[model samples]
Structure formats: structure tokens, C-alpha cells
Target: MTANPTATEPTLLSLPAPDEWPHWMGARGDAQLAEARRLVDDLKAQRPSEARQVLRVWNDAQTALSNAASIASLFSEVHPDRDVRERAENLMQDVQKLDTDLGLDTELFAVFADLDDTDLDADASRVLEHTLRDFRRSGVDRDEATRARLRELSEQAILLSQEFSKNIREDVRSIRVRPEQLAGMPQDWVEAHPVDEEGLVTVTTDYPDVIPFRTFAHDADARRELVTQFLTIAWPANDAVLQKLFAVRREHASLLGYATWADYDAEVKMIGAGQAIGEFIDRITALSGERAERDKAVLLERLQQDRPDATDIDGADATYYAELVRKEQHAVDAQRVRTYFPFEAVRQGLLDVTGRLFGLEWTPVSQEAAGTWHADVATYDVARDGERIGRIHLDLHPRDGKYKHAAQFDLVRGVRGVQLPEGVLVCNFNRGLMEHDEVVTLFHEFGHLVHHVVGGDQEWVRFSGVATEWDFVEAPSQMLEEWAWDADVLATFARNEAGETIPADLVAAMREADDFGKGYDARTQMFYAALSYDFHVHETPDLTERLRELMGRYSVFPYIAGTHMQCHFGHLDGYSSAYYTYMWSLVIAKDMFSAFDRNDLFDPEVARAYRDKVLAQGGRRDAADLVADFLGRPYTFDAYAAWLAE
Candidate 1:
């Protein structure tokens, strides 16, 4: 793992310095674009006799450009300060335009096209081929006027995507809950939500805030109010923004000779087309749709156990009663289970388990060397057999104006023995001890970081990290969640403040109870997958109505009037045509987990096999080929189907 002189060389595998990432990168964004243009000009100025240096020159420029834009964009999304976010967003627009220009530059593509691939390795050759293909898809082959129009469309897309996501972050609404309404909620949760002078507790739409209130708060009126507000986030304003977004996308797709954005986007996906994605959903729905109805009836019966004359079930009421049924049937206390899984301990346990599985070790960077934007964030260096290989940053708390979900952002892409990749695992877990689901989430996001780091072994920047086909990218992450379910793995760190291990039976019960909502939960995910998938495939004027129709058809609970889940459906912002990627990815994830199922959950042999065949390959191979190599067979849906049935 010593640094390779031909790559970044000399100072490689040094601790990641994300703190070095400019806090307000507005100025840096402009400078980076200027350098990028200069580099591109240099490429054009090079002699025809200089074709030997084309790969090195172009690869270096692309790396610098990507690093700048990614740093700026990531800050724009997650920075705690609004001023920094605004500045970053403003510069990001220009970066996006320059990015488009640089990528679609006919002159640069010609240089790459002129180069002989005979000198390049297989991976570098594949990288160049993909670049050309992407450029063609971007309309590089179009007439001058059409190419110019495509550039305009590309800039508009960058702005609209920014605006659509901004609306989701900036839209503000909160509800006042009466003190009595906090009944049935965990005491810690109750205490966290303090009442103002008016004696009304307040809640916002953040997952930690609203989800707990809905799931455990006994106050029907409070849950109803919170649910309504949560559903309508980015409404009225973003509604039109989304329509415009999709319209532009549809037009963009048409320009590329595709019927819809779904088809246009699926040109490089595992499923191949939106129609195939739809058919997959139809197959699952046919098998599970009736089971969802039965699940709903069971929940309604539980609700009626209290309100004897209850006539209908609202989405808010479903959660309150579902918790009751879980306890009654499976003896699980979702909140009580949190006592065993503190944030710090869970982090340690995750590192330990993954380290043992993959034969790696993690060490925190010295505080002086740990460059961080927020004091809460920390950095760690990953090593294998004493050779530093990668760096990871942890930003695991929620605050006002922060990105509202859990995700891993690749701050730097590494090539083996070259530039060590740096990944930021940003999540919104409770600062307090987390619930088991949050623990699962911690593992899930960590899986992404591992992929970003382990998969960074590739030689080309474009092929580095989690660069697989979009839908299959989540499979490795989801596969890691199985470790969270293992009792032995949890025992490694599932201890309370008192230092007592979580009881084996308690862990067992929570695991069992977590499955109680599977029938309805699977249906809920399917409803979302279909709504997003069907819309992009067949664009229509009445998107809200289409959303309502899908919900009415697939949802376990009846659709509520005046509620608009699509408004908060941020997936539409970027994931529009590919929202089914989650379930689609899970099919492969479940199959991969089968390798470890027959052996020890932490079987090192299986773990190393997964690392070598899947995680380490990145985009070096097609995802199907990787899966086939790992499993020694073509992938199948049998494991996924059985999981759903279970």
C-alpha cells in the first residue's frame, strides 16, 4: 500500500483533510473553473505528436474539476451556516455550467477519440469509452444549434435541481403539541421536546422529531397535525417547481431520442429500461398487494379495540396502533431497545465488525491533524496490515439547515496506492443513544463508506469508489444491514449507560417485532416506487392526482384528503425515474447476503470474497458480471421473494 509515484505519489495515504475543504467555497469554485478552462486549453494547444500525454493531462484536469465541484456541492447541502450554504449554491451553478461545457467539449472528446487505447490498460480504455458514450448521450453529435440548446438545457437542469432540493431544505413548518399529547412517547424524547411559555410542545418534520411523534405519541390530534404538515413540505411552491423539473427532464430525454426521462436515464442501469422496472414492480405487487390489505385490516382492528366505533384509519392512527400490536404480539419496545445502542458504542462496534470481516483496522487522526468544518465531525484513517489505505469523516447529528437525511458523500476518489479516497458519512441520528433502526442505518451508511474506500482500488478516477450501475450501488450497503441484525454483533457494543449488555431475548424480540410491519411496509415502498416510476415513464399533467391514484391502489391505509406526500418526495428532485432502485437493489443485496447466511455471520472468508469480487471492483466490471462472479451464478430474485414472504 506504499504510495505509487506515478499516481499522486510521495505524500499519498496521508490523513484526509476535509477541514481543508473550504467552508465557503464560492471563491474556490470560480478559481477551479478558471484552472479547468486553462487545462482544457492546454490540451487543445498540445502537439498532435503529444498524444502520449493525453490520458494523463485529461485525467488530472477531470480529477481537479470533480474535487472542486463535489466539495462545493457537498458544503452547499450540509453546511450548518446558511450564509456558507447560499454562497456555495451560487457558485455551484457556474460550476455546473462549466462542468457541462468541459464534458461536452467536442474538441476534448476528439482528443480522447484520437488517442490510441492500445497503450492504456483495460480499465482506462473502458473509462474513455464510457466518456465518449456519455458525451454522445449529452448530444455531442448534434448539429451546432442543437448542441447549443442542449447546453442551455443542461444549465437549466443544474439550477432546477438546486432549486428543487433547496425548497425541501428551506420550507418551514412546525406544530404545537399539548403536554398531555406526549403520552406513550419515551421520556427522553418527551424531554427533548420542551414546551414554550405557552405550554405547547413543538415538533418539526425532521425524521428524529416527527417520526417518533407519530410512531409513539398517543395524541391523535397531534399526530394528525404533524403528519399533515410533514406531508405538505415544499408544497405549493415546489409543486410547480417539480412539474417544471419533470417537463425539462422530459424535453431533455426527447432531445436524446428517448421517449421519457426514465428511458433516457436507464441507458446505463441494471434493469435496462423503465418498462422492465415497472414489470418488476407489477410482479411484486401482484404477489404482495392482498397481503397489504390484510395487514391494514389487522391494524384497523387494533385501532377499533380502543375506539369501538371507529370507521376509518388515517396514516397517523396507523403508527400509534401498530406499536400497540407490536408489543402485544412480539413484546418489543422500540424505544426501550435504544438503551443498549449508544451512538459512540455503536460506531465502535461497527468499525470492529467490519474490520474483522474485511481484515482492516481504523485509527482516529490526531486532533491537530483532523481538519473538520464542525467540531462534532471526526476523521479516521483506514489501514490494512499497517498500510494506510483510506480516510473517513463522521458527521452524525442533525441541526437546523443541515441536509435532512443520512448519506455518504465521496469527498475524494482514490486509486490504489495513489490518492487515498475520503468519504463523509453524514447522518441525522439522535445525539442521544440511538434506536436499533438508527443503528442499522449507521451500519448501512458505513457500508457505503467502505465501498467508497475499498472500491477506490481502481486505477481510473471515473472507475473509483461506488461507481457501479446506479440501482446496484445500494446493494452492498443494504447487505451490511444484516450485520446489525446479528445478536453477536450487537453484543459487541449493545450496552447501556450502566454497561450491561442487551439481553439476548430482548434483541431477539426486537428483531422479531421489526418484521411485524413488513407486509404493510413492503406495500408502502411499492406504492412509492410505482408512483415515481410510472410518472417519469408516462409524463402527465396531473402528477398529484397520479400520486393519489397510486397511493389509493397500493397503500394499506386509505389516502387522506389534502395530504400531498409527493411534495416531500425529494426523490423526484433527482431520483425521478429510478425511485424503484431501492427494491431493485435489495434483490441483489439479499442474494449477496446468502453467501454469509450459510456460514458465520462474520465469516472472514465470505467477507473477503465479497470485498474482492464486488466492493473492490467498483465500476471496473458491469454489476451483473460482478454478482455472477461472486455468487458463482447469475442473480435470482428467489432470496428477495422469500424475504418479503417471511
Candidate 2:
């Protein structure tokens, strides 16, 4: 199982003490900011050299705060200390303010705009250019009043988003399941949960509790009720948060001189405009809809055969019935796959794959090196040719007060001379034995971890790994999913403690089952992308109404009553109109993977070229140019469309 970092052990958690290293770091940053202000006064007195010193001081202050904020943010969700959480949030805000005062935005733009063709500092030049672009997209170029208003809107939005997320984290619904209702569930799952006075098993709303209950529970009415409760998380307050956030975002975009929020968001993305995303979504929806109808018919036929008296299936039945279909058609069971893929084996397999593909080695670091998020979090040192390159911390699992999302948090970005080795990956996957599909999720997240550790070519921290165009950032990570599907790669790590191998036929059957409901899954994702874009692009006063209208046209399942999914869709503010990045990057990823398919899947030369040209370079070059150069041609959607056809 993918590890959930939030689970509790008997011992006390080893979180950072209030007076740890970051406290000094925070103080140092404040001092530097004060020094910069003093230097600015000196600059007004006509000392040009002193002005340069002030700029350096301001840069130093910004870097210190940035580092502290990154570490604190990751730790805050799981950190037991209230002080640490508040300190981290405060430092992040201070850094945001410093960014505004340094004139770093305009200064960096001027530095890049004046670069000579023959300049050897290409990495630094590219970093400056990227920073300038971010500043412009952030509305830093607006007049004083407009910029202040935009900043206020941003601050308000951040606070609201944080509060919304907190509510979801704390909102736990307890369910009681009798022994008869838990017939098909694994023994460990049934025992792990508590039993109430009535001898009914009580489970919380965590994915570990919710997913198994949805798939294995035999009581139809109980399953339906639980699913309804799960879907309606963070209801009334979160819905209000979404409404206010929508208005704030619209105003922020207007202040930046854009026609719609979508226009403002897509301006700095790789796609160049909002229209391109709309066209791409439309094209995929047409193909996905055809396949979805075919799959839905097959599912319905099976449902009738299994339950001759049942009339219709709804959202709650989807998972349970899908598992039944898999068992009937392919004789594949998710729980059986979990026995073969223990968490430790999957992690080792990923390390082995990276070692071969990128010529790197990993060594475990001391827990102290990880600096106290939780005792279970593991830190590792990444090296190539016996030389240390960088570090990555894996905080896997879920617990109370922890962030309930699966994402990679970049704690410290690596730059050539400016920053030390730094990075981290955060996730909330089950930590015990995992299903085969869960192993694929591991590979996908490891893709992000490797991206962070490989140290890109950019000279500044702002343009480092995973900091490029939002639409293009997913390409490297998505391409790694292909590795999980390969038998050769799977064989390297799919072993028991006694060195026994899993049967080859089981792996093949697992792959077949994995692709079984691709169409339905793809369509569901398309619905989210479409809904997110439509909500941002519309100028209407009611976002929920707009969301419902779009859902009616695009979503296969009927919208559930009394729930607004957008309230919990925290990514709406950040990714906003850029949700199509997932699909766009999938196209590029498929084309990139074709190289390995054409050559041998394990071709050393091909792997080496990919590592050098794409993964290692990061955002030093324009993303389009980098992709073209690596592929020896432009990216095309044929591969993506054809993959869906399969």
C-alpha cells in the first residue's frame, strides 16, 4: 500500500521544536530586509554602488524567507506544534511582501532584456526572464492603486482557501457497519477500525476507510448512504468560500487588464491562450464520449445479470460493480495484487528504475536530517557517480490535522551557486501492502521526486525544476507512468522477502484490468477540466449555477443534490483555467514515451539522451524548443488519441 504519513505510532511524534534552526533563519531574513531599507535610503542620497549592495541584501532576505516558508509549509500540515504552523505562514507572507518591495520584478526584467547574444550566463539570463514573466502575470506591472488592490485580493483568497482546506481536513464522518455488511472486506481493514457498543464497526471518512467500504460492502443502502455523506464534505461554509473566491479572482484578473480569469491565467502557460484549451477539451470529449457510451452499456448489461431485480446504478455502485466486472472478465482482484506489492518493494523498485535510467544512487539519511515533520517521514540523499547531488524527503500517509491531498511539496529548489541541495515530495497514499494500480501511483509520484533532485540548468531558484510553464510541468512525470506498465521494469522489483517471483500471467492480467475502464475514467477527468474552465471563463454572478449547467451538458453522472464540489476544489484558485494542462502534457508525454517503444524499452542510450536533454535541463530553455529538440520533431496529439483508443 502507498504509505499514509499521518498514521499515529505509540511514541510521541518528533516535530520541530519551537526554537529550532528556522527561528534563526527567520530572524536573519528580517534583519536583511531592514538592512535593504537602510540601503535604499542611501541610494536616494546618490550612492550607486550602495544601491547595488542594497539589491544584494534584498535578494538575500528574499531567499532566506523563501527557504523558511517552504519548509514550514510542508511541516505545518503534520507538525504538532501550533507555533511552527503560525511561524511558517507568517514567514511566507513576509517573503511575499519583500518580493513587492525589492523591485526585483522590474530589476530582473531589465537585466534580461539587456542581455547580449554571446552572453555565457545563459542559465542566469533565462532565470531572470522567467521571473519577469511571473511578475507580469502577477499584475506587478499595474499602477500603484491597482497593484495594491490585486495584492489584497490575493491575500484574502489565500486565507479563504486555507480555511476551506482546514475544514475538509477536520470534517470526519463516522460510519457504523455490522459484521454481515463487511463480508468481502479484508480481515485487517475490518479489525483496524473500532467497534461501537452495538457491535457495528465504526470507520472514519479517510480514503483508507472509504475506498474499501465502497468496493467491498455488500449492503447496498448502507453503501449509498456513506457515499452521499462522503460527497457532501465541507458543505455550507465551503460553498460560501468558493463564491467569494470567484469574485476575488474575477476582480484580480480585471485589475491586470484581462477580459476573463481564463485569459489572465493562460497568458503565461505553454498553450499561449484560453481558446487552445477549449478546442483541445472539445476534441477529446468527442472521442471519450463515444467510448464511454460503449463501456457504460457493457457495465449496465453486467449489472442486470448480477442483480436481476435492480433498476438502475448510481455513483455509489460504480466502484463496487466495476470490481465485480473485473473479477468476472479478467479474474483480477485488487486485494490479491496488494499481497505482491508491499510498500517497501514498490519504493525499492522505483529507486532501481531511477538508478538505471538516470545513472543515480540513493542512500538513506538520518531522521534528524528531515527536521521534524513526523517521526515516520524518511529522508534520502541522491547521488550520481558517488557524488551527492541533492536530497528528498518522503512523508507518506494520512493522519488527523494533516493535508489530505496527494501532491509533491518543493521545499527547497536547487540552483548552481545560489542554493544548497534541497527538495521534498509529500503524499497521502496507503503505507502497507498496495494494489497494483496503487504501485503505478507510486511511480508517478517518484517521477516528481526525481525531477526535484536532478537539479536543473536554471541559474536562479525561481526558474528551477517543476517551476516552468504550468502546462508543460507534467510532461516528465506523466511519461514515467509508462514504466509502471512495463513487465521488464516491474520484474526488477516485484519480489517477496524470500526471493519468490509473482507469476507472469498475473502481471499480464493486471495490466489488462488496468485498461478496462479507461474511457469512463478519462471522461470523468474531462468533466472536471471542462467544469473548471467554464466556471472561470463565465462572467455570470452565480458560479454554482454556471457549474450545474456545464455539468448537465458534459458529466455522465447526474449532479448530486446539496453539494457544491467546487468549494472543495481548492485548485480552482491556483490552476483555475489551466486545468487542461494535464491533457496537454499527456499528449507530449505519449510522444516522448514513443521513443522508448520504438527502440528497446531498456535502451541505455535513449534513456541517457532523455535524462540529459529534458529532465536535467528544467526551464533553462523554452519548453516548446526543449521538447522539439528532444523528440527531433514537434509534439502531436495522435499518440494520445491513439492511446485512448486502445
Top candidate on TM-score is: 1
How far does residue 214 in candidate 2 sit from its true spot (Å)?
2.0
Tell me the tens digit of each residue's lDDT in model 1 across 1-646. Answer: 1111474441332322544444436555666677677777888776253333665566666666766676767778887767778777877787778777876778877877777677767777787788778888888777778778878888888888888888888876889878898898888888788889999988888888887888888878888999889888888887887788788888888887898888888888988986787887777777777667777787888989889999878687888787888788888877778888878888888999999988889999764586566777878899887877788889898877878888898778886545778889988878777877788988999999999988886666787889999989889999999989888878888898898998889877877777677777777888988888877777668777888888877777677777778877888766887888888898899998987854378777788999999998989989999999999999999998788777
TM-scores, all models, native as reference: 0.94, 0.89
Which runs in model 2 stand beyond 4 Å of their true positions?
Answer: 1-62, 100-121, 309-312, 496-499, 539-545, 598-600
State, as a TM-score between 0 and 1, how close model 1 is to the true structure.
0.94
Deviation (Å) of 595 in candidate 1: 0.4
Q: lDDT of each prediction vs. the true structure?
A: 0.80, 0.68
lDDT of 2 at 517: 75
Looking at model 2, residue 416 earns an lDDT score of: 50
lDDT of 2 by residue, 222-283 (tens): 78777877877777677777777778888988877887788887877788877777887887
Question: What is the Å distance of residue 68 in model 1 from its true position?
Answer: 1.3
RMSD of each: 2.9, 6.4
